[model samples]
Target chain A: MYAAIDIGGTKIAAGLVDSGGELLARHEHPTPAEEPVTAVEALLGRLMADPRWERVRAVGIGSAGPIDAAKGTISPVNIPAWRDFPLVARVAEATDRPVTLAGDGVAMAAGEHWRGAARGRENALCMVVSTGVGGGLILGGRLRPGPSGNAGHIGHMCVELDGPPCPCGSRGCLEVVASGTAIAARVGSTSAIEVAEAARAGDAAALASFDLSAKALAAAIAGTAALVDIETAVIGGGVSKAGDLLFGPLREHLKEYARLSFTRDVTVQTAALGGDAGLIGAAALVGHAEV
Target chain B: MYAAIDIGGTKIAAGLVDSGGELLARHEHPTPAEEPVTAVEALLGRLMADPRWERVRAVGIGSAGPIDAAKGTISPVNIPAWRDFPLVARVAEATDRPVTLAGDGVAMAAGEHWRGAARGRENALCMVVSTGVGGGLILGGRLRPGPSGNAGHIGHMCVELDGPPCPCGSRGCLEVVASGTAIAARVGSTSAIEVAEAARAGDAAALASFDLSAKALAAAIAGTAALVDIETAVIGGGVSKAGDLLFGPLREHLKEYARLSFTRDVTVQTAALGGDAGLIGAAALVGHAEV
Candidate 1:
């Protein structure tokens, strides 16, 4: 058995997983962003005290980056307090178990590849289009974590060289165009759900906003297909919840812009694991890690 | 021994390669884009007449899209006469050897991964920034040909959503901003060399053009690093000959925009193989195909 932790800016989730990638027990808590170390320690302590924790042999963590997977450290952009935090060592010290780490998007991709929409697919991209656009890759049947565990930061890839400037200091990144934050920002709202509802109600402004976002996403997908030659893209996150309102337009735009025959064949679909992907993928690390 | 053929719009290069991926002998001729089949046949005849052909066991071909690698058919966008042409069968008939085919860019990546600049690197992207931008990928130590073998068409990725219309029917693709064609077009010239020379001579317009191209390319590289998590990018082709004029500004832009630590770690370097990359990469196909 293994323990998987999905650490986000707002919430921290923990799960007990079996060798077959099954979830035996799960729990969640609001993240204490102000006290980063204490928050993580408390979360781990609470989870470790649970009856399910007795069976856990290892721990896997997925966090927002920039991360040093090799060193098990995290320096999340949103979590300013987590500058070079020793995530893996702290978790291991608290739990007395082996630990592994990866970016949140990478963990999501692992979950999808292991048992979700991208199963059996050797080359695929798993993306989370939420508050921010994050990505993870399964290329040539292996997980690509990059040199610093920052692989799959697709949101930051410049989609429009002259478009809006991203918080990362780049212009026209996919995140700035297609992320839930971008969507909300476009409609002058605070949540993606509002934008989705507005678009569904035939709000021209909302619809236009989504159309632009979808086009940007499709363009990025087409480009990504060309770059990595992946066959499928499994999309997850809040923005993906818009369903056809997002995917239909995204596909239409992809067909228009996908110039290469091979790239045109790429399929973009919703993720199958939903929110559980991060935890499941983190657990999957115990079984598959080199990728 | 293996026979490798690089079928370009303007040239046909054939090489005899040993098991160690060395070129034993090489031949080159101008390609008859107007009569691709005849040109290919003529090249095959020349290759077969060589004594090295007697020892060659298989033939590998790399051509421009859209090719059906599984069916060994070619329909290059630039070679109007190659629509649905049975290139593999023709080559097989000519050489009396088994034949395999892939996109020229894919083959280039395979070649680089097998014995060139990308050797020992598990995940790398090899790009040719010549007349038009092209790319090939080695992901997780495997060559990615994608579904239709037209993967690695990085030049077409939209870097500017409203920058310029590409021949591929897309607006603001990376190729429109950073490719040799795009650079030359921006300068009202016909070749990247002229643009490079102008930039070298402190032509303000040319320097600005290169800077813009570098910025676009840097954004794309940061994006690619975000998606695939590769550590190194080995760049080749005529445009790369500009050396520091291109790379200096690219690195500067990347550092400024690549806020993610992992993405910031990505190294962009010149390809080590130089002009021989295509032929050597073609020869590297033998080992790649077997794998």
Candidate 2:
């Protein structure tokens, strides 16, 4: 058995996972947002006291970025309380087992590649298009976290060279143009779910907004295919749940952008694992090298 | 000893290279633009007759793409006579040695990574910005030709989603806005060299052309960094000879586009091997797995 922890801006999740990737017992807590590392230590304490902890051989952590896997620390954007927090060391000490850390993006990709949409694929890209766009690469059938464990940052890639300014200090980044925030901003809505509801009710503004987001996503996906020759792209997260509304236009625009022979055959699939991807992927880190 | 062949649109180069990467004997032939495979056969016959060929253990061929490295065939866009021509089999038959094939872009990057500007860098992008932009990647201290031997075709990646139509069927591709052909078109010149001369002579049109090209190159490089976390980019080819006319603007624009912590430190350098990169890279293929 493996112990997994998923640290996010909104919540902290803990689970014990079997070798087959099944989460046997799960626990969750709303993130304090301003709490220090003690909060995480307390959560680990609860998990270690569980009887399943006796069977756990290793611990895997999936944290929000920007994480320093080399330094075993994280400085997530939304969590203001933790700047370069030593999560890996603290967790290892609490659990009394080997610890591995990966960015949430890398963890999601690892999960998808291991047992979900990208299964059996040698080269794939798994993306999460929720509040923000994030992704990771599966190259040669292994996770490629790169030097800083930030290899597959597809969200920040510039698709429009002289387009609108992004919060990341660049112009025309994919996240700025395609994330749920961007989709909401396009139609004067408070959230993308509202936009999706409007689009389903035949609202023109909402429909056009989804179209534009799909176009931007197609460009980024096709660009990734050209750069790395990925044969499959597995898209998950809040936006992906919209189903054909997003996938229909994404497939249409992909035909226009992915014109090269090698890039032309790329397949886009809905992520099969849904919300459990983070915990499953975090546990997967125990079997792979630290990202 | 290695027998290296670099097959380009205008010329075919053959050389005997030692293990140290030195070109011991060199020969060149003007490509018979309309001729069939016999021309390459005749050239190979001359190369085989040389006494130095007796010591050659393997032969490497780098050809203008689109090449099917897996199938050992080539169908160069410029050389219409060879449509999926079986170059590898023919070369192996003539030389009686094991042979390998790679795209010209992959060869140049391999050459640069092996001994030129990108040498010692584990993750780098080596680019040639001549008539068209072409490139290859070095990841984890080795060349990553991807699944199709075209992993680092940076030129074809879209940077400006709505900019301009590219010959490759995509809009706002780096090649359309940044290649020597693009520079020449921007300046109403016959070639990029003429634009370089005009820029050196204080011509506004020529200078603006180079600046725009540099901006596009910067966006692509920064985008590449975001996607793959490449640390170094080595620029070569005809327009790269413009020196600071191109590099100055590229560095400045890179600062603006490469804003993420992981991407910000990317360094740009001039390719050290110049024109000989193709042959040397082709020869280096004897040591790597098929792209």
Native-referenced DockQ of model 1: 0.67
Candidate 2 lDDT tens digits, A113-160: 877898899999999999999889998778888887777889888899
lDDT of 1 at A264: 75
Regions of candidate 2 where Cα sits further than 4 Å from its true position? none
Report the C-alpha lDDT of model 1 over B175-214, residue by residue, as the tens digit. 8889888788887988878988998999988888889889
What local lDDT does model 1 show for residue A165? 81
Model 1 ranges with Cα > 4 A deviation: A46-54
Candidate 1: what is its chain A TM-score? 0.95
Q: Name the top lDDT candidate.
A: 2
lDDT score of residue A183 within candidate 2: 95
Q: RMSD in angstroms, all models?
A: 2.4, 1.7
Quote the lDDT for A45 in model 2.
80
**What DockQ class does candidate 2 belong to?**
medium
